[model samples]
Target: MKLFKLNKTNLNEVEQIPFKLEKDIQSLVEVNVESVFNLKFIQSELSVDKYRIDTLCFDEENNSFVIIEYKKGKSYSVIDQGYTYLQLLLNNKSDFLLVLSQYFNKVLRMEDVDWSQSRIIFVSPSFNSYQKDSVNFKGLPFELWEIKRYSNDTVVLNEHRSNSKESIETLNPTSNSTISQVSKEVKVVDEDFHLSKTNQPLVDKWNELKEEISNLDDVEITPKNDYISLMLNGKTLCYLIFRKNSISLEMNRGNVKPDGSRSKNYFDLDDPKKISKEGSWEWKSGTKGTIYKIPINKTTDLEYLMFLIKQKYKNLSN
Candidate 1:
């Protein structure tokens, strides 16, 4: 990657600085772990059984543990190591949470954790073609991030996202028994899961909404176990959960004020009353307040739904 700086009318290329050691990369990341990935730093060089975890973190939003390994060389299989670490977490939940509680001085509960969304992230200067291809499966629970530093003191971190909607369970059916067992426990949910639970009409409406949002700038749809989140620049803009008769929308602009009362005028829309049928205008839970339920039973509801979606898209871009 080439970076340029404007010197009057001419542009000068910035020199690329290669990281000297893996430890240097780890230290840089560990110091600013929360800001980079919104993860709470657990411990570095954590020796779990025979393996040593490079950097362990806790994802507060997803309520899961994220294992991040920094690599300077290319000689590891992402699938094998990723699954192995995931299996280790699954087998020993208490041990992981205990260490976290001790470090942060707070009691971390076992039941509050979401094991299915547990994943491993590999950060390196670059990834080989094989390593990138290994995580091509949509639901592998592994993320590859390439990090680089320049002489200008600017660092770039790029995540290699998969375009495939196919799950690893279907693609890797003939894999080893360990992977198969782990797959059964910690599987990634797709759009099909929501479709199976809801009716055809609601599913059709969701598809329509998804397609419309896909046309917007830098918008990507990621299907989770409970909901489908619309992400812009890796941050969640809107979260949609498929209910029995309607699709619930939750806008994640930021934290809402912690008030016990659920108000009708919660959302700052031009006409909040118009989209009331879409979902409840009242605030719901703590951080995820006001889950607006948009019913797909009528064509008019969809027309009104566009306003809610566009508002969220606009807020995210800003």
Candidate 2:
């Protein structure tokens, strides 16, 4: 994508800056990984057996490990490298947990991580059509991102989304054993997977809430393993969990006062029938803010829920 600077009604084209070294891209991304990918940066240059990972990160939202590889050349096969890295992680889980525990200065057990959600991310300035098409299979735990720097000191990172409807399992027989093994362990989750867990009435309610939430400004719905996250500006504004009868809406406690109490500026604090001050899965996953839970049963709940969500949208967007 081309970027232009507006100088008093005149458009000046911004020059693109090429990365001098692969390490340059790694450094920039490592320092800003949280803002860029909403991932916590672990150790860089992590070595597991014979393979060396460029940057290791933890996805708190998914409770999984993310392996990032930086590339400056376009000749390497992304499919091969992506599967190799994933296989390495599956084979050497203890090594990754050791690094994660040491980096966070805490002891994180094996059960604390969701291994099925693990993924590999390859970042480069550009990718060939073959590299792009290699990851086109649905439910493949691999992502390709293009990173570009500009003369205006602005940087852009864009993810390559696949349009294919085929699953990687279709070609597992012809592929190597490593591909089959990794495919069995890592699963890419989507909305349909979550929607399949509930009945049709709850599904309809979820769709209604999803559409209303997406209609809000700059809101993006991201489906995770356990919940559907509503994101604004790369930060999670709330989470929607599908239940047996109703969909639960979880949001961060936004209007807390200095004295450890919350104000009623955003949500209706008196409505215990709809809102609850209970701890949510996000709180258990080490998120730094308080999470509030609200249930959506019918159309009547949406007006109040969106009213609360709109306040959060305004706050986060500002």
Q: What ranges in model 2 sit over 4 Å off?
A: 174-176, 255-290, 298-304
For all predicted structures, in order, the TM-scores are: 0.82, 0.87
For each of the candidates, give the backbone clash count.
5, 0
> What TM-score does model 1 achieve against the real structure?
0.82
Off by over 4 Å in 1: 6-11, 104-109, 165-176, 252-267, 277-304
Q: What TM-score would candidate 2 get against the native?
A: 0.87
Clashing pairs in 2: none
Q: Candidate 1's residue-wise lDDT over 1-318, tens digit each? A: 788889999999999899999998999999998888779988999988888999999887778889999999999888888889999988888989899789778997888788887888899999999999888987678889999999889998888988887667775586566688788778666777777887777778777877777777888787776788888877777777887776667663333455544333244545465554333233454533444444455354655677777776675566
Clash pairs detected, candidate 1: 278-293, 278-294, 279-292, 279-293, 284-290
Question: Evaluated with TM-score, which candidate comes out highest?
Answer: 2
> Backbone clash tally for model 2?
0
